[model samples]
Target: MLTERKHTLILIILLVSLPVFALLHLNSGQIDLGIGTMIDSMFSFNNENMNEVIAREIRIPRMLTALLVGGSLSIGGLLMQTLFRNPLAGPYVLGINSGSSLFVAFTIMTGVTFFQSDLGMIINALIGAFLFGLLILFFAGMVRNQISLLLVGIMLGSFTSAFISILETMSHAEELKVYMLWSLGSLQKVEFHQLGIISLIVFLGLIGALLISKQLNLLVLGEREAKSLGLNIKRIRYLIIGITALLTGVITAFCGPIAFVGLAVPNMVRILFKTQHHIVLITASFLLGAIFVMSVDAILQLLESWMVIPINAITSIIGAPIVVIIVFRRLR
Candidate 1:
């Protein structure tokens, strides 16, 4: 009851802050909009008005993308950690992003223009992320040591990155620039139409993961325990993989491969909440993750005049330290 109450208070705080963050994000770009003006434009405004155009067309989509991407990746990270029983397990850490990058690179290198559409790229990236993710699972079966598995995943990322380098060298200037920009990762590029597709895929994945929360709770207890208690470990593993892949692939496809949002956010939530209950962790992960990414975007807006920062770069720089701290704690 006490833990629930504590989490409930945090949850309420998050519920209230999400919109406040949205409003802040809406007002956070190069040209700032005041709260009164943001409300006026959102509630009642002329269609031809410039503020309305900026608010509706530009800010809203990016804001929504940040929330969706952050929430989706965070939740996906939670599932991956549980499935592998490794504190360091996550979509980015496990080579899911690398897998997606490899396929996305293929699309650019081979000029598979057919898969170049928003939907097509999504499909291509899905295959890549899912395949590499499953490959990690295969390695998980072979190697039980978390450190060994971590090294394997890192090697997988390095291997795919080498392929990407080769592709870039063979490509023309235009293709090289396109791949480079995509690799840099940003939420600003996803338009309203693309946001719609991302929202659908990610939300469905979230729902699917949440529905299996009980199984996740049991799975964390160990495969033998989970099986003794009547949980289908194999089935749950595959389902977790599917949801993680869907969430990671869609976000990577649209926003580029966002590093550390998944790994860092879930670990942060666990530390803050101090519980293994999937029910609490999942909800906390989504809300907290959304706030985390929005906060990063706000910081970027503050530094925009002096620096052109990629969201991925900012995440990696900040997240690496957090992950290292977590590693030390786990070692202890």
Candidate 2:
């Protein structure tokens, strides 16, 4: 049990470290711009300056994308784990990303001009994620076993992948190329202009998650207890699903299916904080999640001279070990 002062101190450290890390991330690129110039670019509209342009157009958006994607997925993961009362549950593992991807494939591979636009893709992704979330909830009611539920989720993912494979085969070469690149995942794909809407969506999801923090904490005591406390269990479950879908869908729409942040970060938060308090968990997850992805991306940028690694691959590399450790503990 952490003291309140300790929690406050930890939260303050995380809050302060975010912008500092963002600065470091901005400086990690190939062009060695001074800190002053980079800072200036954020405020000043100096289109003629190449360094400022790079900072404004490329680095800023990528950094912000990593921040938003990391935080959103972590929260989504937290929600899924809480809703299911399972340590391993997450948007990625339970096929929410697969659902979003399947819809994105439909939008991209169909060669519809309107659907290829950012707005079109976001809408489709949200619908797919929401429907899949409901589907997962439905199955949760049917099965008594967590492992069985996880297996069903895996099967759902495989089913979606098979459909995607079919789309890849029948699609035009250009369309196929586009989808392939997107599926590989890249934070650099997001632009400065897109950040506004992305931030807004993430903000809304975060607010929703926070508003239900009390309900989430009650849920930690078990569904029956929560219901006995006059917590509308069904409504809370639906809300969690909706918020999870929104957070997961938007991130997937922009960042592709980032694996394991949703699973790994929230678990890390739980382990580090050792608390079942949703407010603390959510806040820590939001900050730490951003910090985690930003750190990975910064390392990648530093190594960009030698090689480029996909963001998805690196997160999976880091998250997989955590998952294994968790499973081992659960087995014991």
Best model per lDDT: 2
In candidate 1, position 146 carries an lDDT of 89
Tens-digit per-residue lDDT, 1-332, candidate 1: 99989989988898899989977887779887666666666678667878776776677888898899889899988999999988788899889889988888778767777878887889889899889988999999999788788899999999999989998989888888887889888898887567778888988998898899999999989999999999998899889988888999998888888999999999888989899899889998999899989989988887888897888888899788877887887789
The reply for model 2, stretches above 4 Å from the true place, is none
Clashing pairs in 2: none
Tens-place lDDT digits, model 2, residues 101-214: 999999999988888888999999999999899999999999877777888889999999999999999999999998888888889989899999889999999999999999
Worst 10 residues of 1 by lDDT: 33-42
Cα displacement (angstroms), candidate 1, residue 311, comes to 1.5
- Per-candidate alpha-carbon RMSD to the true structure: 1.9, 1.3
lDDT agreement of model 2 with the native = 0.91
- Supply candidate 1's per-residue lDDT for 294: 90
| Candidate 1 lDDT score relative to the true structure | 0.87
In candidate 1, which residue ranges exceed 4 Å CA deviation?
35-50
For every model in order, what is the number of clashing pairs? 0, 0
